[model samples]
Target chain A: MRQSTFNNKFLPYILLLPTMFILVVFLFYPAIETFRLSFFKVHPWTGATRFAGFYNFIKIFSNPEYLHSFVLSAMFAFAVIGLGLFFSLLIAILLNQKIAGIRFYRTFLIWPYALSPAIAGALFNFLFNPANGVLCYFTGYRSWLTDGRTAILVVIIAAVWKNLGYNVIFYLTALRNVPQAALESASIDGAGAIKRFFYITFAFLSPTSFFLFVMNTTYAYFATFGLIDVLTEGGPAGSTRILIYHLYKDFFVHSKTGYAAAESLVLFTLVVGITFLQFQTSEKKVHYQ
Target chain B: MKQVKMAVMMLIITVVLPFAVFANGGVDVDESATASIEFWHAMSGERIDLIQSFVDKFVAENPNIAVDVQYTGSYNDTLNKVKSAYKAGNAPDVFHSYEIGTLGLINSGIISPLDEMADKYKKDIPWNDFFTPVQSYYKYQGSHYSMPFNSSTPLVYYNKTFFEEAGLDPENPPKTYKGIREAALKLRAAGHETPVTWNLHSWYFEEMICLQDEPFVNSDNGRGSELPTKVAFNSAAGQKVLEWWVGMEKEGLFLDVGPGWANHRAAFGSGEAAIIMSSSSDVNRLTAALAEKGWEMGTGYIPRPEGAKGGVAIGGGSLWMTNNHSNEEELAALKLISFISEDESQIAWHKGTGYFPVRKTAMDQLKKEGWFEENPNYLTAFNQLLDSPESLNTAGGLLGIFPEARELIQSAIQEMYAGKPVKKALDEAAAKANASIEEWNDIMQ
Candidate 1:
């Protein structure tokens, strides 16, 4: 790439102004304020604030419910990612074949990606309602959603189903880019299809997998807020209550603004830590052409 | 550099466009001889059309006032929207909030108390004519904070035909916890899969506390000079209520349909449940639902313990006037609300939806016309309140954190159902509620 010189020295700075302005106004400002407010106590409705350094953090950390939600969210993210990636990759490889009506099938399969989480939650809620749910009637377990033990599985299924389209799109593109020559040459050495997929195709798709891992992790953490809120409101003995749902209840429903802000900080730190770890692992494992 | 700027602009659009689309674009009101007031409500379904019709009549009556009525979502959504809108200085002239929000709104310092506004406007609103329970429930610190709109108490609805088949008198419905349990078992034994169910709610628990003639929280059920410091529902009355409830669930006599107002209704309508406890406001819908199956439905007082002394506390929303409006706008808003509380409006509202009339004159008129005689189910709820002795508990607990407290109690009930001891669950709920109350009290101070 060639470096171009600006006709006017100040032109480049002027061009950067809008982006900087938005970044400060929307992102940096709230991020900084959230950090500051986490140390205070805030009234939800009144927006009144009082400085109580470390008090909010101490209260939440000591809360057993918060710890339970933390573990539940970690597990939920893991299940969503594991099931989501594996199924998407399998579907992507199938779609990579030359099948008749491929475009129609692909469009039908990928349509859920266009749906927001709220829509997915509502759809699942209608299907799993204990009274007259279609799926519950078929399954003969009306308490699929009302039972605390089974409701988490229902939520996980909804989350994975909603994200499947997004994951498949990436996987399909990555599958297409796997070197055909390497596969054919390996086949000449009597390598089975599964062996080739594990050796060459999988290695070539490592970077895409890593990118999706991070994206799915973030999605499980934040995007499922609406799903949990509409489907359960974190109910049935709080079985399906994830960390984001807890933060929403504290911030929006309960109006404990300072406590919610503290929760936000905790969530941000978790995400950042996970991303940092992902970077350290990606450098060694991810392949770049 | 040009390309980079364009890319950044695109990123900003992608990020900010959803907010822009979601931003409320309603017109801002101004003070003039033609006063335009915004009236936001939480009523949906057919009630939206009913409210609009009422507002249309009001607008016709007063040519100078133009009232804008918008149906915001549920009670929670409306309150949250009002809070954000209030902060942004776009608060509606008048808005609806559920009954439990009375203390929270009073202390928020953002609402104009209805009594003060009535006095300011010199309007002759017959506050005395409002049904006693409805009038007193919204009163805090000896002042009326909001105008009662759709007030209701939970009522027990039973399938009359099923009762007869089970060899129980259709005319005589259960009135005590023991009576209800016996009736439920008989109904189930008679081959009704589920005998009774109600949408899971803390309102029922709170009402049971009131029926036992006990305060729900300290400091006079949070109605005294000092706000509530801790909840008192972990007492014997609370335990008795939960034990009876959980026992029924265990016996499979009562259907544990879980939380929300819809599931239990559907269960009952489909004949999967023979009896359902729900808001008196549901009389119309439940009756019609049973009629669809060619069955007659009956209503009875919500069952209680044998010797409980108190009565039902009202649920449902009320209309609140917001602060920061000019005197003209406030007066116009007050006129709109007072019009809603008038006997004519109350009668129509009571008939259209089965929420009991809020005014005594409406009840008198309905009685004179033999309205209750023809539709006796409506009388069950009104009589339930009329017979209730007034006490701090029956007046409904006044706490700034009542919403959160209700949620805590609800989760506790679920915990009990899922195998935790009733006392243990209630105690845990009380402790959590007290923690929230203390934090709320601290912030208020």
Candidate 2:
């Protein structure tokens, strides 16, 4: 690989310039600003700033609502990732079989990936609306969103539903690329279908699963803000108030930019930590081929 | 190659031409030059059509001033858009802002006070002609920051059919919380599934506080000599309101239809709820929807607790002009504002939308035309405002974090509904709200 590298160093750096510029300008700049903002109190409209060392962090950490949101975010992430991975893998495996209209089923399974989180939230909200909702006809017209526990459950279900298609698509692609001969041999060696799946096919899908775990975690952590905003608005006594939604309320609704900035940094650190931990533990078990 | 070059040139022009036009348009604001100004608002559907009609009329009369009206989603979305646009130095010349955001906009120093321009057009648009509650709610430190546009207050809307079925007089709807409970019990005994319902909005809580003659925050509801240092919403009056609400919930007299007003509307329109508390602005739509079902609607003041002395404060939004505009553009914006607030436009606006006419002359005109004779429900809000005494409580609270405070109260209410003790939940919400106020005051300082 070293020998095959371009002999002209300027050409490589020039080739990488666009991507590096993008990363620095879009990612690093905002991240650094958020870090700097966390140490100060800033006004949202007037662009005024005042220094307050660790005040934002202390205020947020000591607040019961913020702490509760942190816990709720963890539960939401775990539920989404767990349910998303399990159901997608099951569906992908079922869809991988050589059946008639299997392609149609696969395409149908991928349709949800096309819907944005906000659209999904709105769609589910209509379905589960207490008054005159389709689901209310079955539930005896009970408003599900008014209760804190059920509201959180509805948000989790929506989030999981929104992310399921992406996970299924990846898992399907990985399953298609799995070595058929290894599975056949394992089956021929008197291993049952379940045993062969666990010993052979499951091993082959580990890498894809690992990648999906990280992607879904990120999705649940940050990308579900639109879903929560539309469906619940972090309501029913803050049951669906995930960390990102909390940050958004403080920044936009409350105009507490500095506090929101501190929250963003905390969320960034949490995501980074989760990613690092996933890489550390899961990479060792992932199979390349 | 020539074709590609042509396509590239076309693309560049397509993208850059608008910027160039805007850049040139920004300059040359002379007496004869047309001052093209953008007006952002949260009006939509039928209301947007009415606003467009008025804008067209304004442009017809004042051809030199091209007024463009743009609908900017909901009120909260509009606030967010304005804040970002102000930061980017591209805010609209005029925008419709909810009254709750008055303090924040004033503190930002981006709003150009309308008092001077209002005086300039005193002959045509008499400032005193506007409704007192509407006008006073937008004033800060003795200066009016915005023009009272789509002002409304909460009203108790009941189904006349349901009231009659429940052996209650439709002409005499319940006027107090205790009376409502009694009426709701009768409604339930008459076989109504949900006797009463209201959207879970904190606006009603604020109105309830006013109805009880209690300040929502200290410093005379933040209209005193100095800014408020603490929230006063966790008072005994607030607790009493919540306790009654929770008691209704416990007895199953009131159905918790969740957050949006649409739910309450649906429940009422479908005859599922016998009585509902909603904004007076909902009269037109609710009447139409109920008329389709052959159900007559009755509108009354938002029910208060027994013996409460105060009245409901005004709700809805106001129009504001931004500061970063040329003199001609600012004048043009003011002209448009005055035109919208004029009696003729106010009558049209009030008829088109259920919002009360903010001008006394408009109301008089409507009365003279016998419009209220047919649409008596529309007079309820106007009568409520007129009956309200000029007190600090009815003037409504003014806080930089009023929106946030409302959200906190909403959360606290939800918590109480979910079985948290009323006082504890309110105290927690008040503490958090006070902290937000302090933080906001610190930033302003």
Docking class of 1: acceptable
TM-score of each: 0.92, 0.92
Show the lowest summed lDDT stretch of 10 residues, model 1 chain B: B23-32
Top candidate on lDDT is: 1
Model 2 residue A73 lDDT score: 97
Model 1 alpha-carbon drift over 4 Å, by segment: A1-25, B1-32
- In the range A25-124, model 2's lDDT, one tens digit per residue, is 9999989988999999887676668899999999999988899999999999999999999999999999989999998998888888899998998898
Q: How far is candidate 2 from the true structure (C-alpha RMSD, Å)?
A: 11.2
Estimate the lDDT of model 2: 0.87
First chain TM-score for all predictions: 0.96, 0.94
Candidate 2 lDDT tens digits, B1-445:
9999999999989998776555334333354567989999999888888999999999999999998789999988888898888888989999999988887887787788787554443323466887888877776778787888988899999999989988999999989889999999999999996788898899999998998889999998988888898999999999999999988987888888778768889989999898999999889999998999999999888888888899888988889998888777887898888889888898888888888889888888889999989999888888888888778888999888998998999999888888899999999999988888887887887
Best by the DockQ measure: 2
Per-candidate Cα lDDT values, in order, are 0.88, 0.87
Misplaced by over 4 Å in model 2 are A1-25, B1-33, B117-125
In order, the candidates keep a fraction of the true contacts of 0.52, 0.64
Report the interface RMSD that candidate 2 achieves against the true structure, in angstroms.
1.3
